[model samples]
Target: MGRGLGALIPDFDEDKAQVSELQYLAIEKIVPNPSQPRVIFDEEKMKELADSIKCNGINQPILVRKIDNAKYEIVAGERRWRACLMLKMEIIPAIVRELTDEESLQIALIENIQREDIGPIEEARAYQQLIKRFSYTQDELAQKIGKSRPAITNAIRLLDLPDEIIEHVISGTISAGHARTLLSLSVNEDRINALHKIINDKLSVRQAEDLVRRSMEIGKVPTPAKQAYVFEKESYIKENIWKKFTFKGNQKTGKFVFSYSSPEEKQELLNSLGIQ
Candidate 1:
């Protein structure tokens, strides 16, 4: 057992319970923590760890909570358990503790966050789950996780993004910084447009922010009566044809700009509008 796990359990007496006396249980009986924040595991790193375990064996005992006489839920060391499973290890050294669900979730979150193993979105989702499931306020969550209130607030705000953009963040297609910038656009259509632009243009975080800000400002600009008809026409197009296009100029002289990443998408848009 590592000193880290020993620190969590006050009754751990290494001298009384020799290293050889540590409890070793069948690997199959242990289940992963439902509240585990880390979803993606680096396969290369896991393979490396597995190879090392094959040579030297797991140095630390995994921490688990007894669910029943025959069942256990891992509180920490899921990565180690995974590595051991990779090596086809039958039995694993473990320490069982009596823990509540809240304690289990907190410990799991702290372990992953401390190790920096979880992604930003994963961390946000963990915070959200903690708040929703445990009725934790933002301030309370911030204090518990050693983060500031604004940091906690921002993390939870990430959930407001559409599922498509959230998928991009989770998949590493765009960074958390980029996602934060997109939050400036309140409209879903505007946010989705900005997301496409970011991916297609490989826009930096600052650039994405500037682009969204400029677009928002343009939308907010006051229109003169001469241009009111043009703006109304633009609104109609946006509401009916596509909300992603840009309309400029006036009723007498106006330009409509439509952007598409591919010819296929352009053709699809044209087909949707009954245009050849």
Candidate 2:
């Protein structure tokens, strides 16, 4: 029986039918908001949910809006909609909402932010989208996202990293602490190398930050040779290398020095080599 909008909804009817107040159907729907701000989605997690739906069925409905003929756009529960598709369901439950272009984007951003599910990278990208696409100021973005302006600024600055560095951060190759250290550098290349060092050495955030601050305090960051010699060498090794090596004094002034074997040791080496 077809009932009016306010009529009582049946618990179960017609062999088997699923309905959800939260999801809607739209046909020929183009994404009203073509661009989304968030970046990360845990595909594995979503697939797990899809598997659950396959076994138990979709208990919750997704929200979609009809844009035109045979097209529907997702508004909320996008993951659920995706899961439903994965399950190869012909007819899926959804709640339809008539949302304007601006309203749809706003809803999507607000929902993701409120849920705090967006990754740091995604959050930064979203904030950037709001500014670039919507022409919103940093202050305005902060207000909308309920964050401080500085927080927003730091998040956005993260995008300035080289793609490799960003990948490192995304893959857990580098800690967020180390990423922040790289972010503090003026040059992206330096940041990238610093990131590599941090990962290779497994330096703590504090250690990385200190290194950065030290570099800034000095007129020029020490060259790799100097850095290795001065900061990395032990006193005993430095003395031994200095005493044994015959090299240029100015060149030897830096952190490293090479050790030379004594004459007696060299003779012993020659005897061992059968060159006496």
Each prediction's whole-model lDDT (CA)? 0.73, 0.58
| Candidate 1 lDDT tens digits, 107-164 | 6765665565567787888778778877879987676656799997887788999976
- Model 1's lDDT to the true fold? 0.73
Model 2 over residues 168-203: C-alpha lDDT tens digits? 665566666677787778876566556656665677
TM-score of each: 0.68, 0.62
